[model samples]
Target chain A: MTPKKVTTTSGSVTGAASSFSWSKADTIRTSVAGVIVLGLLFWAYLLSSNTETGGRASFSLLIGLALGIVFERGRFCFFCIFRDSIESRKNNGFLSVITALAVGAIGYAIVFGMYLPDTSGEYLPPGAHIGPTSWVLAIAALAFGFGMALSGACISGHLYRIGQGSLRAIPALIGALIGFGLGFITWNTLYLRAIQEAPTLWLPHYIGYAGSLAVTLAALGVIAYYLLKSNTESAPEKVSGLAVLRSKFSPATTGALVGVIGTIAYMRIEPLGVTRQLSAISRKEFEKQSLLPETINGLDTLAGCVGIVTETISNNGWLVIGFVLASFAGALSANRFKFEIPTIRNSSTALFGGVLMGWGSMTALGCTVGVLLSSTQAFAISGWVFFLFAFLGVYLGIKAKVHTL
Target chain B: MSTKKISRVVALVASVALLSSITTAPSQAIPKNDTQTLVSADWLAKNINDPKIVVLEVSAEEGLYERGHINGAIKVSWTKELVDPVNRNILSQASFQKLARKAGIDNDSTVVFYGDNNNWFAAWGAWVFNIYGLNDVRLLNGGRTKWEKDGRPLTTAVSAPALGDVVAKKADASLRAFLPEVLKVAKKQQNTALVDIRSADEFSGKIFAAPGFQELAIRAGHIPGAINIPWKTAINADGTFKSTAEVRKIYANLGIDGKKPIIVYCRIGERASHTWFLLSQVLGYDVKVYDGSWTEYGNSVGVPISNPAGTVWGIA
Candidate 1:
């Protein structure tokens, strides 16, 4: 876990500066810190909320933190991992994401079954899919895939990288926001035919959580075997772009940790949805009267049309925000805070990207994290569709050579 | 060579000093009044009763306007009142004149707009007003629900003001989308993609909810050869648009030839208008939203139609 020193060349800055670089010892320490932070939050939630599910709450945060630490350390981002495979034909990162995803799906299925009280308990929140396929889902997945390539990151990356202060991450964030807004504007149409028409492919419905878990684990096993034996190879690095951020962290370690986070995210919150966190921000905006609610809600009701939404721990906004701050603290304590203003292209990308993301997230009903990871884990077909199309979109975007801005 | 060195040194010094001055000017400078375009509920809460201002509630629902609205605010039906049925795009100048007159809107009035949801339709109405040379209109960020949530002010009575004298200025053709213009873009084809920004069903002309829903059914499919890139795809789940990268992804998925023009459209044009804002104004696409959209083309006698989701529609 020794941190690898990296050299970066910035037009505006001189010397080989590293951001988020931590020694192996530093990573382990920060991960321990992550555990402590999660524990403290769990304690606070237990004390504050007068709910009987305190144990579940505590476990969820603990697992989520472990996952976050692993993810941060390994850089288990769908966009980055997926892009490595496509652009450079590097299979290691791609296989890592697939492996984590398989592990998560199976792990959640087993956990849900072992823990579920009954059939009704198996019912997941609206975008939390275990796998259902629909045209809308397909389109969204492809689009998400495309987004990852173009932006060079996914929703999760944008969220965590805020701590690293990567200027390009800002544009990516903005793009996500704008995508959500536009999604809201066009919700009515997508909902009526595409979203509504698509069948929910919930695992619990057919085989129960236990059976689903078994199948998921089996699938993961198969995938891991296939990936491990494949002829795919990692690209030779002239210099690691992430080397600066690689303190006690390496992509592999972070990837595995993210798997843990994904699991905890499911157990605690409804699921690990990065897009919904963004959605909550929009909802708050509507509530604040910054944007119109009824129109926005009615336009993209599928995205915003949560009927009888729980105001409890089901909301991931608090957790996402808390995790981000904790990440900042972790990087700072490790002496890995690189807070450089991004190049002009990077800044514009953030602004414009945020705006586009706001629009797209609204129309698509979720982002990569929200629909792709969370819902895919839940076995929703649409979730898969979103992931696939978004991936395609990202690929096309990258291929087209669109400037960052 | 010495002269060149002196110039470089002087340029370096001047640039440093200028950068320092700009950077040191303000870390938290409060923007001026004009700089603040969106006024929050707190601002409207305090200024609701101001004599110089007028509030208007524009919605499709009828009795809801009567049931509850900001006090002294007038009601305008976005579908019926704000737009001309024939054009189904921008309101006719003559119709706008009448509606403005009925709402007691003077050219100089500082009109604030809000509605049930964050004033989306209302904002659209306000935008129309602004485009028509009305500068005093502003959207109440978070709109009616926020106001009601905060218990700001409400009245069950709808205002009936004495009609004001508002004259008709010809429709700003520059601010509108017409068939001729669309046809021109359509002919260009690859350089231009018609974005039927309606729902996937509307674009595919499938899953009709009601029979004889003429407005909903005009021509059931999308434009003869346009891409069904709904405006909604631009936003996130929480009702905000996706970020710029997300947007490019959305468009790129739709096979949006960025080098070409993208024209977005919907049933009446309100939703498409938002897309127009995102694409042309925000993403900087050479984009135009078809304000007339389905309402006009679908109902048109000669326009074509399709059914059963054959072409690329929905998220793909």
Candidate 2:
């Protein structure tokens, strides 16, 4: 990035680059965010003192904190990444996804090997929730992809965007919850039919862990090779007013880090899932009203898109809080946090997009975190299925956006 | 992936397979039958030759047992054997007696049940036997999964054990719950807990049925104030029932203390049987399997329904 020339009253010349420039405003913002973060950690620690489950919950929140920081600074929003590639033909953003998938796949394979020393059996890796492969899954993923295009962000984006004081995020979040409700209502019918008939296929089940690993890596290689080879342009230098904690990072750096962090989260507690907290909240409310059925179809002890609705503070619940707070902290550090309320048009679209994402994710048994990222890494066939349909949905959504006023 | 890329990756994996003999470690020790009501793969493996020991595979899939199952195991289809051919009710006592004799089971038989879908239908078979007062009934812990995982020998040969006398008695009220009794439990709210052993969506009446199944009910919702704890929670990762203490604690946390009489149900009662076994036989609770379940309740006209999703027919 080009540095700007700055001359203080003292007749000395100095070049100031991005993110390092300090100002009273930056310091104030950082201080406020830091205090809030420390407060949250203290609360989590306090919670942990009561039980072992509390301790795990706190650790999960810390993991989410790291995720929030990386996501905010790296601009790792899936919507923007795909949109930039499909609309502008700029491919840099795509590199991050590729790198993340590469790292995640390797890490997951290692973990799977350790867990299932005898990989030949029909055991589904615990906690992966390798959901049934069916038409329902494809349609759901397509819906989620379309929602991402419409809302300008997926579930993760909405949370982090709110950290930056984007008021449109509020509607998006609300819409997602509503969409989740809709998904829950229709889940039984789907579960009994298509989902029941659909096979829960895992790559390791047939090919062995090594074969699945090789296949996944080879696929990623082909994608990365073409992406890197064809894209000749580097990013234009970023120029911002009154920079605080902002710093430019390569997609490889952010992606690899994301993969490593996500794997670690999965290894210790559960896979990277964002909707558990939201759905849990909705489930609890329904439970109170006695509106829930005696049983839901398909969902049992599995962890994924439709997570357990619990009265107690779950690990994912705490993670949700930590993600939002840490995202704010990250934004403040980078001086990227700004309160930008959307116009009626943008907000309406975002809300609808949120609804679509929620419904699609519910049907698919996960969002980006649960399906495309985590399942893909786990070598589940649903990963490939979701990948294909979601990309198609995103591609068409982008085209539709271009055609609209 | 595109067709070309898929083929390429498949070829690469296939080539890799040729180079190395990839060993897959199947997850070990199918679920253990820890409680009195269950038997493990190891236990069943050791006892299959006993004259009194009979292993029956009752699965929703018509030909699952025929494909490859435990050696000498008999197949029992839910629709064909357990339920009435014409009505939704369970088979009559005479029908039960006939089916039991055909499978070569008698009053003294130590019949063990197992099946695919994590023993979803096998549990139902166990419940049916309980109603007919089968003295010694057990579910194979981890069911077919444990049997297969441990590398137990599976044969497709049909069994022809000698028929023994087994008379079907009156329906056992202690094990089965009727709609009126369930309604009474709801109205009274005494030391009786109605446990909905289904997934969360079914509890919420968000949808009429699961993804693959056609709608089974006219309405969607739970009985008034039923606690929604899916049946599979009682099961371990290997498809075995969890330890008694652990399982007891899970229900206890859900306010279903063993002291309280518990009524368990699922969409059509098969899944509920799994939970019923866990509560009544494993955790030692006074539990009743609601055989009518959601299908009966949701379809009933003007019955008290608590559909939180406010599900309307054909609309979520």
Candidate 3:
């Protein structure tokens, strides 16, 4: 039997039919992307018009837009990045993370020097993502990493993926809500037992900015070097001009952009975090149902995305909204937007994994973006601790072939 | 029946109108029976069941009221309820009236304010209540700490009393000082005394704010020429106010006599309200709290600042 032939728009010979009808699909998608951009602009205008949270929310939305574009174009998913390194021994994606840490650390050092010139003083930089270092943090990171492996994405990864029409993310997010409730339930005992007494070590506090920056850069340099040495993949071919918008950004480029965005975000608004709004929404719901403890037991005093029960959408909520919408636009422009139907197996696993990630993030006070990325940039030892344990958890989960489940 | 009869009627009407006017005028004096500014916990305990007494627990601590509050006390969040939800100002007169009525605060009610954290926020509540011209607002002397330490009764029960008919007056400008008024004192152009009621570190520009506080200023320092009298100086270790004579002496040593109009301030005016209460209510001095305190003064552009710590942003 002869195989059927597909015709092109120009009536030329073809094989392997296009995913969808090609004649108007591209134009429709491009138009939709344009409309999304317009929508974002209108949303920003409305946010800025609000008297209470105008400037802050607007700024956050812009930052979120930048982050969304970078994350989508670079495919900056922690789960995928770790999986490549652990399962296939491809270390290129991991290099981007190191690059981001290095760039962000430098930026943070400059900002910190300006904010708190004398690091010898007991004062910490305001709004920096510095949290107490404890066993609980380590355990939380491990769970988070394992969940990433299980659910196929981290919290941020799931958020961005939702923009690409990943249906499984919906259940996972719902599961995360339940997970946050559980975290609140267990917070009091854990806080009193360990987090209360834990040491919040800022590297600059001990060694000064010069020494801290040197240490951070040197460590990142070593990691980058190791990643380059082990990486088997060749560098991607360079693309320029208008094509750049449609093409995937190089990992280094993505990292550098993310670092710049993060620094600007920290300078203007709060630290780069995605889970604060999610956690807050969950917390508010739980409080309404009388599920949360009357007090969160020193949670407010500690930093890193403390969830407050509020009726109005916070600046962080605006940031998340911008992130999702901009990611959708990016996906659409790249022709990567596809509505993936959720299978029973994928849905169940995603939900379970999301629950673990949510519990882990809530207990740790942040996720990869908040803790590992933002905290490390600020030279908090907690960030490095989280990085190590989270990597280990991913490695173990991948070795166990949890992703197949 | 003409001019003489009309004159006689006019004279009678004038005398009656005069008598009514004299009788109906509002008195400025506090009733002789309730003159105390600082009420003892014992006094509150005895009057806990008094329908005319409304106790308000104003706390900065989250969920503190739910955990336990003084019996018959209503919870008031210093951050949420006392201030405007949108603007950086006190609650509007209309909003204050609604909150007051909801809390069963009648015009004649003797409102006693207390809270955790050494009664810093409770004093702020008292100041806000005073701003709306509540006549008989009082502070619990030792606040929650002393009460808890003395093993006084606390309950988780919430009261839902009948709505009150309290009418809120226009916010009294005399009780609250604004930035322009404070700037005059800071620039030393005005003869008023500026009392900075923050920790020594904060006053010295060594730290922006008290540790763990969310509110902050861009620059670190106190207003130029402001006297540093930490609010805690007026309180004993037991969280009760020092005797009036001692407090007077403490201020007198700093050259702040009742003669000069004093403006008290802290990071966000809560601690300053504590000092405001001490100076105006207890010591019977002319004082006002600059609600826009260090957070305002430090952040304001081109404002004169004194940083003896040699702290400059980005300069080591």
TM-score of each candidate?
Answer: 0.45, 0.56, 0.58
Give lDDT: candidate 3, residue A37: 74
Give the residue spans of candidate 3 off by over 4 A: A1-24, B1-316
Q: Best TM-score goes to which candidate?
A: 3
- Candidate 3 TM-score, true structure as reference: 0.58
TM-score of chain B of each: 0.63, 0.86, 0.88
lDDT digits (tens) for residues B1-316 of candidate 2: 7764664466457545544432321112222233656777877776665555678998765335654678878878787679997987889999899989978786767788999888988988998998898877888989887777677888756666566587778888788998988888777745579999888998898878876666889898799879999877888777888877887788899899887788998888888998888788676678898889989988888678898998798654
lDDT for each residue of candidate 1 in A113-218, tens digit (9 for 90 to 100): 4333244533443324343356655655555555555566676777767765566787777677656655554655676666666565666677776776667567
Question: lDDT at B286 for candidate 1?
Answer: 69
The complex in candidate 3 yields a DockQ of 0.02
Once all C-alphas are superposed, what RMSD does model 2 give against the true structure?
Answer: 14.9
lDDT of each: 0.57, 0.78, 0.83
Q: Rank the candidates by lDDT, best first.
A: 3, 2, 1
Poorest 10 consecutive residues by lDDT, candidate 1 chain A: A1-10
Which of the two, 2 or 3, has more lDDT?
3
Q: lDDT at A155 for candidate 1? A: 69
Give residue B180's error in model 3 in angstroms.
35
